[model samples]
Target: MQLGCWQDCIGAIDGTHVSAWVTGPDTATYFGRKYCHTQNIMAACDFDMCFIFISCGWEGSMHDSRIFNEILINDNVTFPHPEEGKYYLVDASYPNRVGYLALFKGNRYHQQQFRRSQQNRTAKTSRELFNKVHSSLRSVVKRTFGAWKNRWGFIRDMPRYDFANVQVLLVSASMALHNYIRRNTGNPTTVHLICDEEEAMTIVNAIPEVEHDNDDLMVGDEDPQMALMRLRIRDKLVYLRNNGMLENI
Candidate 1:
């Protein structure tokens, strides 16, 4: 994670909904916000676009934060957890907690916004600049998801299986294969081939809206300790930017 001032960042965490076919009593449980039966697949990926952790089998209707807290947090999953002073970059769907660093909500923090700022060469405010860097670094997770789904057609539209557990197994196997290919080949062209510009843009635009019911209560109620930590990190990033350390990137 060589994200300028965010070098302590271990990885990025996010969730992607995979279409699933279900019937009978379980259909209602799998019906998701997209008006389709699906499975919410949560994953953590490093800066190199390699998946470090993945958790599937959660119902599509489940909130990302809930899946994270229940499956990853309560279960003591240490793979995604970072060491002291390290954190994973997450989206607005997750809380701005100590171990997780979320972008500044209600602010411009997307690739489009960053590109526009770069084109104008406009000196951005501290928060805007922080968000610019945050968005760029976090995009790796989105690209990884897009490339994985594009590489494996089954994940894009999973077929109806006799057993629901098979869906989970398929997803696990796909991720394992994805990692194997990435490690053995040591080539980024494979990832780029799967996730073209159009496909990547589609995935970015298709990101599900934040679940208001799950996030509304926590909005604007950030813990004082966590708030201070964010401030320190933001200031350090600004310092790095001022010193021209990030201009090349």
Candidate 2:
């Protein structure tokens, strides 16, 4: 898959807080560790990075994974599971599951992105590799969230009514609209979401260049450090090569 995931990826999962203008007794429930009072919204995106799920109105104090488990369970959501099976990408704040890939401390995604950065302020192989791979694929989900928030700005300005109910409706409507856009527009934005095997192969064959830069990172020539960097870069390059995304150019 373009995401380097199995073809059945239902997309990445993440939560964002929509700031509210009103606060009262419920503020404590809605105010999260981030020190902000808002409604938490959990969302799912597909391969094309379109939002397929958006559950909102939960107090910000709730964990993202819990919100997902509560609202997006079977029967409630109408979307069919991917043929290979459905899975989602989530941050460390989420627990791992057969249906979800969690970015925890030991996870390749997080370790490569954060571990080395913590130990070495400058250059780290894993960091470089993570950045490279992250830039390439992770942007899809991020962009999806950005677009959703942009379209549903009302999520932030919830009226002083039953904030919870309004929040739910807003999220549901947003997702429905997102799906509508994909279906009506024929995936003009995705280019190839529901492509046939041949079409998928064609896309796979069109390898894009991997944009990597070694200049900004500081490489320390020492034991464990240099070795770590080498290992990270090696692994990352291997992945890129396997994906046929490294451009000869």
TM-score of each: 0.78, 0.60
Collision count for each candidate, in order:
0, 0
Which regions of candidate 1 are displaced past 4 Å? 76-79, 115-123, 188-221
**Using lDDT as the measure, which candidate wins?**
1
Q: What global local distance difference test value does model 2 have?
A: 0.56
Please give the TM-score that candidate 1 achieves against the real structure. Answer: 0.78
Worst 10 residues of 2 by lDDT: 221-230
Clashing pairs in 2: none
lDDT of each: 0.72, 0.56
Q: Encode model 2's per-residue lDDT on 55-100: one tens digit a residue.
A: 6677888887677667657576664343334556555556545555
